[model samples]
Target chain A: MIPPRFHGVALAAGSAAGAVALAILGLWCAGFAPLAVITTWCAGAFGNGTRIALSLQEAGPLLLTGLATALAFRCGVLNVGGEGQFLAGAALFTAAALVLPVVGFALPLALGLGAAAGAAWAAIAAGLARWRGVPVVLSTILLNIIAVAVLGALVEGPLRDPATTAPQSALVADVFHLPVLVAGTRLHLGIVLAFVLAGVVWLVHERTSLGFEAKVIGLNPAAALRVGMPVAARQMQLLVASGAIAGLAGAAQVAGVTHFLSAATTSYGYAGIVVALLGRLHPVGIAAAALFMGLLDTGGRACEKQLGVPHELGDVVKGVMVLGVLIAAAWAARRSAAAHQGPADG
Target chain B: MAELVSGVAQSALTAAVPLLLAGTGELVAERAGVLNIGLEGLILAGCIGGFAGAVLGGTAGGLWLGVGGAVVAGMLVAGIFAVAVVYARVDQIVAGMAVNLLAFGAAGTIWHALQDAGRDSLPSGAGFDRIALGGPIVFDQYGLGWLALALVAVTGWMLAKTRAGLVLRALGEAPEACAVAGIDVLRWRFAAVLACGALAGLAGAYLSIMRTHSFAPDMSGGLGFLVLALVIFGRWRIGGLVVGCLGFGLIDAVQQQLQGAGAAGAVSYRLFQALPYLAALFALAVFRGRGNGPAQLGRPWPEER
Candidate 1:
């Protein structure tokens, strides 16, 4: 019999194999050179310094957003408000950037405010779930639409950049931007912050009582409540924390990458959910998955130039990969369960 | 003033039909214990299918063919979702989101490919004739509009009065009990999802063939999500759903009218766009416990050994 420890590994391996096979098939069907697609994907994702830099830049936001989703998922909460929270964070940070005087600490303060704003946004859903019988999933999706609307209003009216005709916010002063970690590339300090947060999440998951309680509530709220855990509170806390993390991702994108707020600033929030699931909701695994997905995002853009494939095809790959992994993991669980029961039946 | 009022009323009816049709379908699925949130993807696929069918089949009978293609596409997509949710025991939210992402990309790819083939403009075709009940402005409406109301009435009757309705209700509330009573929970749930998909597809077909008479990528534009909200606003009841859809549709009509008239000023059209979603949240928050959905709304039925 396979040990319980190796079970997760088996599932991961199966999902990866299936995802790759499907991706190849999709490329072939789309009339692209399958082998060339992979090579170009690799080249555009990480072959050169510029590509590597772009991947890291992409990974920075994804890391935080992925962790945000994974943390909530681990606690049995399907918090789909990461996108909304991310936008809230970016919007808040931008608001601060416009108001606060440019100082060394202003960037950090804006980021902190962004996280708080995200938490506040998420708290609306948490509050509804707690007080009303409204489901978090429904509320979160609703909140995402509302957030998008809010963004549109801000950019088109209050935040419109006078110099540009498009609906975008005014760029913050260069002093408000994050310091470059690597010269000649776009790598910034936010990437370091992302890794630090990942470590913090890992420690909390492994060593903290709060984490234990959250996990317990996730597994079975009734049992957790019977065992004296604050099921409701923990659920709220985890959702808020998830929102805070996503907010940080949004803050990073604005301050480190875009230097302005717009509709597209928080696009990675949905992709981050896919990353969290792909990483099996583990902190380290989520980090790895974020980077891998980051590579794909960069590579997808490259396909436009190299193979004339639409960059949105990358989105298809991401969706298919997630689906493939989920199906494969389910298959593995069923197979293992069947195998385990064979001897008993005999 | 009379003309404006009729125009608004006509627009409201046109807008509400799609939401009503989709919401009613979702109501059935929810009654059968499956929450199929991939309605957005199914609708989009239907749009593409309906558009393609109409263009290729020609206008004489192309509209109906387009709708048929949409149903097939929606079912095919929803079938994938059903297998994943019912048989493989996948997370409903994840599966739904994944399906949406796939639909978004797939539809875009097809749209772009069509553009490459020199069909860049919106495909021109015959739309449903507007039948005037009272006057041209007051009651002139697409046949699809009438068809949607008929579907709502039919769904309402089927769910409330039929024996199959009782079984579906029982299955949703207590799957184990229904299983003990010899009902195949999986089959019923699968069938419910397909029905939901077919209805959502019809809504999509109506959008492309009747309302716009053209196809645009991502044209559904969260209409699926709006329908999901309407289902909740309706409290999962068909009668309430009709009211909810009509109310939201009126709001949408007014928003568009105001935008067209350029009266929004500082509020911005985007704020008006946010109104429907905000209204949904407000409705859900205020009307929390008035109408309860099925007990096991999203729980996957465990396999019987």
Candidate 2:
């Protein structure tokens, strides 16, 4: 039998293989050759410096959002409002950047405020869950619609770029732009920060007492409460922290890539949940999963351009992968339970 | 003022049809213990499926074909969700979310493929004609609207009076007890999910064919989630569901009218558009702790050998 420590690694590898196989099968059903799709996907995702840079660029927001989801899931809080939190951060960041004087420190200050705005937005759901007995899952989903509406209103009114007919905000000054890590490529320092933040998250989650308390709450809330842990307070804190991380992702997207707020931004928050689940809610795993999803995004576009495949193929693959993980995890849990209880229980 | 009032009322009925259909379906599923969060995706799949089928048939009869395709598409997607949640014992919420993503991607890909294949424009007059019910304009509606109302009545009766309804409700509250009594809890739950998918699919078809006359990506929006909230707001009863749906529908209809009345500059139309969602959120907050949800809701039932 395989050792318990390697179970995570084994599951990851197994699910990854299953995902690839399933994607190939799906492509074949759509009339594409399996071998050609595989080659094309690989080459498109890692073909050149520019391609890799684009993939990493896409991975940045995903990494932050995935980290947000991971932290929340670890604490047993289903914070599905990552999308709303991301939008809140982007909206606040844009408003702050448009008004604040162009300075080196202004960028960080605006990002901080954006994160705070996300935290505040998330606190509303937390408050509702704590006091009013509303489910965070449902409330956050509703809040996402409201957040979108708010963003739409802002862009068309206060944030409207007067110079253009388009319904989007004015671009932030170049001083607020994230510095390029590669001189000739679009790779920005935001990705570097994302990597650093992932490491920090991993350290805190694995080493800190706070993380321990959160995990206990996740595994069994009643047991944690019995142990005198402040369950509600910790859940509220983790949820806010989760929102802040997702908000940072939105803020980074504004300063690093888009430079303005618009209604047509990518659904990074929703995609991040897929990443977190695929990564098994572990920090390092989330980082890798983020990159994998980034590759799918880039490669899917490449297939669309080169072949006739749709770019949405990436979403299909990601969805299937997460489902595969869920099934595998459940099976593993049952198997281990049976093993622990010996043959008689089975 | 009478014309305006009737116009708003007519629009409210139109808006409420899709919600009522999907809400009724979700109510049954929730009562049977499966909270299918993938309702949005199922609706989206139905939109594309119905649109494609209608386009293929290219006649009045295509409307029926479109609806059939929608029901089939919705059930197909929900089938995956059912397998994962009911058979594989996956977490219902996570499985539902995955199903949503899968449906979203599949529908989008199919739409793009259709566009590429030169099926770009939607067929004109692809919807059912309004039938007069012997009153004002408010009494006239598409055949589906009347059918939706009938569905609510039938479902309410089925839940209240039928042995099948009792078994279904029992499956939600105490599956273990049902299992002890030799009931196939898994099979019943699976069927409940499929039924929800079919109804949600019908709702989607109503949106595309009867209401909007065209399909757009993610057109179902958060209507599925709103149905979930409304189901709760109604206190898990048919009467409550109808009242909640009509209330939200009136708010939506008024919001649209206000937007069309050139209130854009004075008050942003986005705020009006957000009213239904905000109202639902407020209702949820106010009606908290008054839920009559099934006891086994969202909990996966592990089948014993």
Candidate 3:
């Protein structure tokens, strides 16, 4: 009994370690990766200075996406198209930056406006799900295609950077870029905001009556309605919140990291699904998962540089671990359910 | 306009061929009460496996071999999914997702290995030769085109006419009721989902080999998702499903046309590409998930107690 309790507290950690072990098994399957290289991949991710910063910096946006997915999913919304919503958010940010003339100390205004636009764009699909009973998964994914097309249309047409002769949007003014936190550190203000948001999500879910409502709706829609909750309104609000968080994630990616928009380079939105799932849909868990994934991502690139294992190898490892973790969760859930069957009524 | 219209029709036919195959397979699978969500990943895995086989073996008949290889590869991948969700009694949706993630990673590993090995004797792509019907309208399509239409007709007939189809439909419509009737519901349902996986794989092969010559990693894009949506929009009707395929094809084609017509930077272009999904939404709006979706779409049937 004592051992099981010990294991219970360590359950999430132990399973995560097991997932890593499974990933090692997957790598070994190829018979191409050498042991020294794997060691180097891990070391390079955490041992050095700049590398760690890049990992944390990258995780900032991913954490937001992860949190967005977790919130929506916890509310019983399956948002598979966060990638598209993210791209649309970037597009919205770009559109806003271009339309609004940058004035002195107008930096905050620009970023805030961009985020609202991003939220509005995502709310379109959320609205569809609310009004029409369209599955969030289907609508979001479809919107993803539309997002790509819109970005494609813009880059190829009016938003085309004529002077540079590349299909990049007009770079947002330097004044609009968020201030870096520590001069030598890659820690930007965005990372801080992500932490704050994570706290806010936790508080909203734990403290407020709204949290109970969201949980009820997610757990059972019919039950929520019978309980006199405005299921539709809650869903709309949750959808918008989910999209806005995802939008900020994409906006942060653009304003924080790339500083330029491209349909091809980034996909933090979809990657967030993996993060959220890995984190088990808990806000703090998402933060940790995003950072871990960000470490793996950084490690993957390092492996490409140091060991010739290719960046895709890291992606392979990620995909494998995700499956491993999910399968374990499924079995665990099933077992728990079976265990609680009241001893078969004696 | 007529010339453009004809061209759009032809393009839509070409685009819709694989979707018709995959969507029909998914239709059958869902009709038996399982969502089979790993379809996108299944198609990718099938493409990679089929591509690997065709490329590794310098066979003269690449298309036939590729199609066969895809079916086997697809069924094998999907078989793993069936075991996890069915026999293991895991959540079908999550199992489908697990299969997808595994397929995606597996396909990536294969692509990297093949590319690292150089083109070598691995046969360069030129599969699926077209049968030119001389004059114009109905005949000069590729082998897959004719096969797609044929498969649609056959599936439609089988679904409406056959005893096996009735058993499958019974499992779909009411698993408990069918099990009470002593039907081997689990086995039949497994067979249906496996069929869906194989057909979807064939469609993936069509994309890499027939549509485009070179096979890129994760080449199915989200066509599988679109086909899944089509299952809804089609209201599970075979004919309507095929029409839905055509409709999606046209939407895609029109989006490209608009890009050609200089709507490139416009947000409307994004909305344009969303046309099919919106159409799917419109469908759910009109039908409201009542008579629209399958009766027992995501549940797995149990064996006799």
The candidate that wins on lDDT is 2
Task: Count backbone clashes in candidate 2.
Answer: 0
What's the lDDT for residue A250 in model 1?
86
Please give each candidate's TM-score.
0.95, 0.97, 0.91
lDDT of 3 by residue, A1-346 (tens): 4374443324455555765666566667766465866687777677677778878888898998888888887877777667776776677777666767788756666566556655776687777777776777777777776677678777766776777767787788876677776567656789999999999999998899999899999888999999899988887788777888887777777777777776574667767877887777778778888898888888777876776665655555555555555666666655666777656743
Best by DockQ: 2
Standalone chain B TM-score for every prediction = 0.93, 0.95, 0.89
lDDT of 2 at A196: 97
By DockQ, the candidates rank as 2, 1, 3
Binned by DockQ into CAPRI classes (incorrect, acceptable, medium, high), candidate 1 is: medium
After the best TM-score superposition of candidate 1, give how far the Cα of residue A70 lies from its true spot, in angstroms: 1.4
What are the interface RMSDs of all the models?
A: 1.4, 1.2, 3.2
lDDT score of residue B115 within candidate 2: 87
Model 2 misses residue B177 by how many Å?
Answer: 1.1
What DockQ does each listed candidate score? Answer: 0.70, 0.77, 0.45
Name the weakest run of 10 consecutive residues (lDDT summed) in model 1 chain B. Answer: B120-129
Off by over 4 Å in 3: A1-15, A103-105, A182-185, B1-8, B88-101, B120-127, B135-137, B250-289, B300-305
Ranking by lDDT: 2, 1, 3
